[model samples]
Target: MSERLSSRSLPVEWAPKVDPRELSIGIVHLGLGAFHRAHQAVFTEHAAAITGESRWGISGVSQRSASVREQLAPQDGLYSVLTRGLDSPSVQVIGSMREVLTAPEDPAAVVARIADPAVTLVTLTVTEKGYRAVAGGGLDLADPEIQADLAGRPPRTVVGQLAAGLVRRAETGAGPLTILSCDNLVANGPFLRRLMEDYAAALVSVPEARVEAVSSRQRLAEQLESTRFPAGMVDRIVPATTDADREEAARLLGVRDEALVVAEPFIQWVIEDDFAGARPAWERAGAVLTDDVAPWEQAKLRMLNATHSMLAYLGGLRGYETIAEAVRDAELAELAGELMTRDVVPTLTPPDGLDLTAYGASVLERFANPALKHRTAQVAMDGSVKLPVRLLGTVRDRLEAGAEPRVASLAVAGWMVYVAAGRDVNGRELPLDDPQAARLREAAASAGPGPAGLVDAMLSIESVFDKELAADKLFRSLLIEGVGSLQSH
Candidate 1:
């Protein structure tokens, strides 16, 4: 066997007798990252294992660069998922992926794979920023990459790739496809549908359309209209694997696994049952298939995701290295609990059968998993985009109800202090790695001194805050006080 982990190097007992080479790629995943590898891919593999299906193979597309491709290509798309629960660590070899493609390196190959008649479902987990949508909503047509794709170049963005592939599928009369979004957005499926519609509208409105362009635009719109964009809720604590994790995995398997992903033992996927065609028997593998995934999506987003961001910002500002450590701080933990119990829970009508109290407790327990080593910095990155998705909804709801979201405001205040001061309480440099970092930093610096001007400045940013939210007297007062307290810390 080679030094690296591959089919030959993997423990034969960990897999079914089915050979990897015989499977066909039926699903094309847009973002080939740790979460999808640990969550959806694992579910797909287990589903196929139960049914002995060979056509449920995954062809993962690393949208940004070739790093993931480089890691998995040599290993026959086999990677070990190191589940870091509270107990001892365990490793398992997964063979759900048949191949990994770098979209940037070969965009045409990606489109062609998606166009395959055999493929019926396309899943995405490209994070919030990947959508390239504007601050409020809709596609950012002015984006250079989106503009380039519109100019007949290879589609580079996630939407562009899907658009091009859908056009091809429509032109070739490929059967209906399901485009499921596993991201943390609200009503992910319908939200994705809106994004696609926006893209299709942009394409259809391309001025002075040539005969060929007109044909392509019409086909793109038709295909997207027919495609299923089912909303989904995915939950798992997939931490970025570190050298220590790889070392432990190598020791466990007796072979180096370069493409390792670390995750918690707990995983839950709530998918709306609206696929256009056949899909994996994911329900057989513990996924909840319901007529309404909204309840589940809301519960996860407002409760779990909102708390995750709060811990990230407040914890990162406190100089904690990992989420586990951050949550270990007694005061921060209380605030996080309050944010869920006192604030976020009120805004959510939890999906049926989900006890919001127990769910919130379980969420904190998951966040406190010491073995997972979920970094505060990693979670805290891209706050400018993350804030709206995670925290602001509850803030909005609370504001409308004439209630003061004191704890929620503190979380937002933590973010401002984290960004404005650019250092932990210990004076360690806190990295402000946001898409709107320059403008945010400028807002902080330009707003004179003290928390009053700083809070006003941060709230004034159009991309991150709704004008109404910024103008609210209660929200402003709370933010100023929260910022002042955090600064004093």
Candidate 2:
């Protein structure tokens, strides 16, 4: 074997799509993780390669941790995306990432990067929790990081950091910025904008003008108004890299790759074309630039994501390790389909040139890709935060249309049972690793020992279920029945 994967070690054939040394950082990306490296970074590289443009290089910031920064820094910000299809996996080195920054280590540097005039665009994939919204859809004022940022800390939280950066932009007269959120949150653009507004509004209450916040409240609001937060829908299954995966990557490359990320063959990004400043021509790289990303977002959130979570909870409870193994089980496979067709499909307005039937089939096929090795317990995490965006909308729609959301309720029930049981059928520990795990488990434990009891107890959680949904006799009955049936397994 050769030395580790660096700009120096790559074979001629495996040279990055774009030359790393020549490219300059024009995009400051928050949440430098597997998904961003596999999805957007690759697309940006492709877009640059096809257009012969090199200004859209990325400055990746690892927010929660410095591990990703550590992984890629020695490699000259280089990494290989191992695309695992049905047959053999394909390895490609990505070069668009020019610089890596750890947000916590140098929060001011992150704000400076965002404020840099050369960096016209900022993107985020910091997951749902990164948004840090209260259940009622505003910035979580109680979050300590937010409080710290408002109290004149260096802005550690994502929202705090973004607010600081935008305020910096306003001060510097850096032209309008396009803040594209590449997470799976519903109406992500508008949601993020609202969070920013909440943050900016909260800054006003700080008796003294916070140094990290805007000195002029109206000026910061105007800067926010000028900025564009475009909603984007991204799809790809990037699994946690294991030693086996690293070994395989080494075998393929004749060199060890520390920052190797693996993914399924399928990858798609549908972006809303509402940028406030110049941006990458992502369409050149096979991204869909559309006027309305809502339909696509809705379809993905409800159909694929909701179904994926359903399979995860159900499959984890049934003792399956990976999603492929779970979907391969005939009964679990059938349940996934029913959730898609019977419950989710009827509620969606399929985007132009999309076939709900074919999309459903393809999603199932993607889920069944064994090479990806997407874990059931991993997807099963953060169910309380995920359920509203992924499943509850369908439940609400079906109920509004005067129909029973049977399979959807079953999906919700799967989560409930998974949380309560905390183990698979074979006595393997299926971790209840949710942001709201403590509260949810407390509710589960306090409930009287039965399906109805669990249902009644969880329904009382206003964060997950509103007054109307919790009050619905049909929903309660379905959940109780669903929970009861799953517990019998």
Candidate 3:
């Protein structure tokens, strides 16, 4: 065969792949990253292929990065995805996207696309921290970004931006649109809609004092009628793209394609039964559409995400770089598996007819996938933002049921040590990434010799975990032991 064609110049064989001119951006995805490309885009591509509907093509939008735009814009948004595994590797040109819009390049244009009637679904993979969760996915109306978007000037943040675009579309009678949140948070859709509507109302409301006067409980219960935030459960381990990914893409395509996304061979999308506007036939392409995504969400959050966090903080502190490496440590891996099967899984009410044991086994296998070098730092970042749902939620749930939460406490303890800001077992510096990282370090520094002091800081931060849990004796004691083990080790 001849040398590979330049990614900048499409080959005749690939021109029929994804005709950008023939596609109107029907889906607007925020946070254009590897997960989105490997998971959502690939699903949409398959859906369109089955139905022969070019309108399912996507218009990717990125708020901060221009690199994806530069690379994808040249190739007409047709990039290749390589799914590498221990035994096999598969390559395919994913054609779900029609173009990309980097917000910095033209904010107005990006907003206009969201407002477009042709765009019926707005998907996101902005991660757990990016959602800015407050009290069980409750709306954080005090957020300045929400305030700004409500004022109708412009949005500085993701929630604000989505609200702004939705308001514009709503005003234009663009009909109903589905806001698909693909983050790891439990009840991801409702979490997103809460913020979107809360922000939009702040824009039209009278005063901040009056808005606050309306209690969040009443506000949330009232807004359930008109909104369509479809909760989803997503799985797949696509690590942050390293320099090697870019080099490999260049070599494979015979030209530099900056936007190439690399991932493992696994993907999944389980969504709740709600969609208002036009939507792609994602079910035709293997996506699960059901009346409830709660069980799946709960299962994934408590098992996959919670276990990952445990490994992340502990492994990062122990000087393990990647999750695979961390799990390879006999003790840590065994501890992780034990925490899941014993503590986390037992607390959860598994979906009807689902085998919890099988699920837990699968989670362990995925974590041990050697090909996906999911870094501990990447998972460990933003503890304050992630802990509420990823860790504390499960702990709080089990506690509410009056069940023993020893393993959960250990996870919390791991978080405590991880946040202390120091070297791990190997003496390599552990660079903390929480929003309150500095404050946490300062507190741990001034804390007493026991883990009680460390646990106190984490629970006391009303911004991070539930305040009621702070006063519990068992919670504090377990965390203390957890801290003592690592600190002493």
- Worst lDDT run of 10 residues, candidate 3, spans 215-224
Q: Considering summed lDDT, which 10 consecutive residues are worst modelled in model 2?
A: 208-217
Ranking of predictions according to TM-score = 2, 1, 3
Compared with the true structure, what per-residue lDDT tens digits does model 3 show for residues 347-371? 7788775688888887777888887
Which residue pairs in candidate 2 have backbone atoms (N, alpha carbon, C) closer than 3 angstroms, thus clashing? none
Cα misplacement distance, residue 268 of candidate 3 (Å): 0.7
Question: For candidate 2, what's the RMSD?
Answer: 1.3
Best by lDDT: 2
lDDT of each: 0.88, 0.89, 0.75
TM-score of 2: 0.98
Return the lDDT, model 1, position 197: 82
Evaluate model 2: give its lDDT: 0.89
As for TM-score, the candidate ahead, 2 or 3, is 2
Model 3 scores what on Cα lDDT?
Answer: 0.75
lDDT order of candidates, top first = 2, 1, 3
Error of 2 at 404 (Å): 0.7
